[model samples]
Target chain A: MSIQDEFSFINQIKPTTVHHEKTLITGIGDDAAVYIPSPNQSQIICTDTLVEEIHFTSQTMSPFQIGYKALAVNISDIAAMGGNPLYYLVSIAIPSSWSEQDLIEIYAGMSELANSHRVDLIGGDTVSSKDSLMITVTVIGETEEGRQLLRSHAKSGDVVFVTGTIGDSSAGLELLLSKGRHGTFNSNEDFLIKRHQYPNPQVKIGRFLSKLKRVSLNDISDGLASESNELAEASQVTITLNANLIPLSKELVSCDSEGAIEKALFGGEDFELVGTMSMDEWESIQQDGRLQNLIKIGTVSSGKPEVLLQLENELITLEKKGYNHFKK
Target chain B: MSIQDEFSFINQIKPTTVHHEKTLITGIGDDAAVYIPSPNQSQIICTDTLVEEIHFTSQTMSPFQIGYKALAVNISDIAAMGGNPLYYLVSIAIPSSWSEQDLIEIYAGMSELANSHRVDLIGGDTVSSKDSLMITVTVIGETEEGRQLLRSHAKSGDVVFVTGTIGDSSAGLELLLSKGRHGTFNSNEDFLIKRHQYPNPQVKIGRFLSKLKRVSLNDISDGLASESNELAEASQVTITLNANLIPLSKELVSCDSEGAIEKALFGGEDFELVGTMSMDEWESIQQDGRLQNLIKIGTVSSGKPEVLLQLENELITLEKKGYNHFKK
Candidate 1:
């Protein structure tokens, strides 16, 4: 089917299930989508784009995974801002060779995620590309009045924390490239692969944390080291991370890779939240079973803006930061 | 400069000038841009993307023009909804070969337009593309309660009107491909070239028209014939257009190209607003000197959804509808 036919099919199926918002004036099938804002709700918006070869290669990624991860990253951004995911606009460019079934499955992956998060697939544009498949998802979310989080809000004496484990995705990519040629994998390998393919955005945890006052937040997208430096620079405070205190899954350690800490520090696509809050707020969150594993990894200090890594009583300044797209 | 460094530069410059809404709690420099929507206002959002080879070539389009046109098309979508353009999120994928100055100029073009419209550049992600340059812009706007215009609202007797001339962009493309070999051009050619490069979205006019009741609207990005048919199909009405009544720029007509009318009907990238309203409403609009040239070229009727082109003596069914991205 052609692009127009595919759009018509998508319109008819309504694959995405959106939680009804009374303020939404219109949904789809127009030049733009319209909705009314709820009283005292602040709107938060962010956009992320995924390219074919640069982001993920077809050798290690499927069409469905691509769709899922594209939306997942944008949702992660919203979560970092302490906003509830509401609506998303997706723009996709497909090559001529892609089959209609591939496109449909891609949308299905996105719709499944959207349904779980209660985000409405409001409006987007589809076009033909000459080379690769690219998807850009723009998410619009809202938070209660004065409840939004920012990277610039971290203060001295706040304890830095992170949700879940890190560096699994980059390790999974490494495994796919080096050992996948043998075409066999064990159970732990499979788990790592799935972790890389699908990341769970900490929306629930982010919303829970937003209620607490005086917190700074950011998602670990470009790796812990890069995001930590960003948070420190934005807040004009120094952040020191205990490299050993950083949480690592047994699966990651058992994988037996050298430079495991470095990978966790500099790799990209973790999709986990890392932020700083006072000890009192952190202790209160620790009481809840849902956040029992939220690990305290460092402390915010009053100093020149920088990120320092501590290992075995020695402190080292970071030399190589996280992934930079334009750096050769 | 690296992508991160470039983003830092953008943050320092704050290229986008946003019309401050009292509800906006935060703008840029964070995980997301936050704004509180005013009470009784309906939010409108739309997104559009432009690719390297599919949209234009380096020979015909400067980096600044590419950036300008990329945002212009999205702004046009908002205008079609009769919503005021507010904040925009831009996602751009750049190849490694591009210079930092090229990237800066691109943002300058978008900034120039954003400042004029008072839309804030909130937050976006930049990635490295393997091959080409691709940019996506998403614009968020709002209208007063119940003032949003839609294509599905065209009534059976509503008259169809178009702002500005049609087919100039496509005509400019033909000129660029056929006769622009030596890079020398006449005054008329220059006018057509500029029309193709810089399209002025009718944002002010759309905001004005949104207050009127029972109006249908769409921007003529694909062409008059294509948008008219879209409006008709959406509203389930028959639209008939007078071929001679469709306005064409004198520069386009004097270019002496064959099939000028057909180009006006089937060519793409016009970026003009074509919609339907009552005759009374049209007359009232005509009384305003700003809207004196809003040409009425067609009428809506209750019939099988289709678009017909009327010449001097014959009414011909439109066979070549518009540019479909996936059509062979």
Candidate 2:
């Protein structure tokens, strides 16, 4: 866009509400956004990128969904660190094929999620791309001093738990990508598609986990097997996941059972929190009404850093088989 | 690249030194980076993006220069705000055509600049693109409490000054783009090309100016005319520029005088600081040995927001005629 058009578009989408008004010295319009930090808190930061054709396509997602997912993924990274997301910056490269209206809709989708979480839109960059549209969001968050969770804190005998269901997004992606080939969409297919398009970050659960002692957490963006391996390697422990105990959404389970299991293990983009905590802490979470969906899926043991899956009659090592952009 | 390859690349380029070690709680390894903020300081955040073909071509720049310039522009934004850059995140989309070695060279360029500024490379995202490569960097900086320069702070009776020579980058770009049409590269041509490829951010001068009262500052990334108009509009004042006083590098003046003046007025990507301050403060800057290159360029007056040029023979209204990505 022309510089004038770019500025006008920025003004049009400028945030109306700032969650931490007292701390925010300045927002958009300046060369850089300025803000103060609470003395009692530590800062958390993470960034994620989404590229058209590589991450998603018009056939798979609308502009709104694409924008929402872009910010959602970054927020999930913050959530994994057990931080409360406060502000975010978006840098987008717009292809000439896209219109200003489409960009506005994308911002709308992001604003909806940002508003819900009271996260402020602080600063960003807008540029023109040649062939594909791309967005990269960096989220700034905070946590109480020394309270942020880490992937390296899991201990032997800690119980591993996952929030909500796994593999629904992968199944949803499958349904969306093969809609015409599959006859017609059913209610289950619709549910899975929504799961794929509108995956939510488990911020509340992450914060709760952070309040507990010695918990290791990671966001499940790279499939169960891959995330489990990361947690294991980071913590220097062996993680054993029970195949039967893994939570699968009803929509995902309604599909072929073997395929569902495979997807649950190796499919990605779930955006759920998977963590390990002491058994005592797990008991406390069990009694909390707000954490009813938290499911016990595995255990951390002191050994060589690796991930293993326990099937009905057999046990096997799980490979890091999640999506890889340049595997070929 | 595959996830493993991406991780290995991250490890290869991970920062070896962190300037503010006490404030950094974590860097580059977990779900997100964590840091502590000093109670006496405010944070500055900015992001910038560079796209292949649109922002740079292989013919005009090497991968290393592209990477260095990407981070330099974002640092310039922080410098314009008079803040000390502390940390940064890079989100890059690499095309299949680029080699891993090329990516490493890009990182090397960025690391050289980053290390000089003592900025930590905390986190980033690396993904695959189908065609063009892109890089977006988000830099976080800090400044003393309530001590930030802004575009809206200029007042009537203020004298405007710009540090260093202007339009050298523009002239350099012209030389590089028309090298074959002209004769082989001369020393002056080489010097101009270097100016285009290696623009410096005026952090020290910006900090010096920030110590003064009520200074309005901007970086001349989008040429003098466009940036002057922005300052005038933002500060709600009319600015009159003395055309002869605008500093031009000797190398730039060696070329066509009229063309050099035009490029100085309308060319972009000359990352020099421009600001307005009281006459007393300007005198103080003049007395400082480190600020000898600062030049008085214009005066701010209370009037309708507009920018004007004071030519030797006739005065005329200056147009905002800078580069716009989508003007066509």
Best lDDT among the predictions, by candidate number = 2
| Model 2: lDDT of residue A311 | 96
Model 1 chain B poorest 10 in a row by lDDT: B1-10
What is the TM-score of candidate 1? 0.95
B1-328 per-residue lDDT for model 1 (tens digits): 2445645655654654457657567776777889888678888999988888888777778888888898899899999999888888888888877776787778888887888888877777778787778889999998888988899999888899988889888888777777652477898888888888888999987887888877899998887888888898889999999988999888888985566787788887888899999877777767865464478899999999999889989999875367766662
Model 1, runs deviating above 4 Å: A1-16, A180-182, A287-292, B1-13, B16-18, B21-23, B287-291
- Model 1: docking quality category: medium
Question: How much lDDT does each candidate structure score?
Answer: 0.83, 0.87
Pick the DockQ winner.
2
| DockQ of all candidate complexes | 0.69, 0.70
List, residue by residue over A183-212, the lDDT tens digit for candidate 1: 477877777777777878889888988888
**DockQ of the two-chain complex in candidate 1:** 0.69
**TM-scores of the models, in the order given:** 0.95, 0.97
Candidate 1 clashes between residue pairs 3 or more apart in a chain or in different chains: none
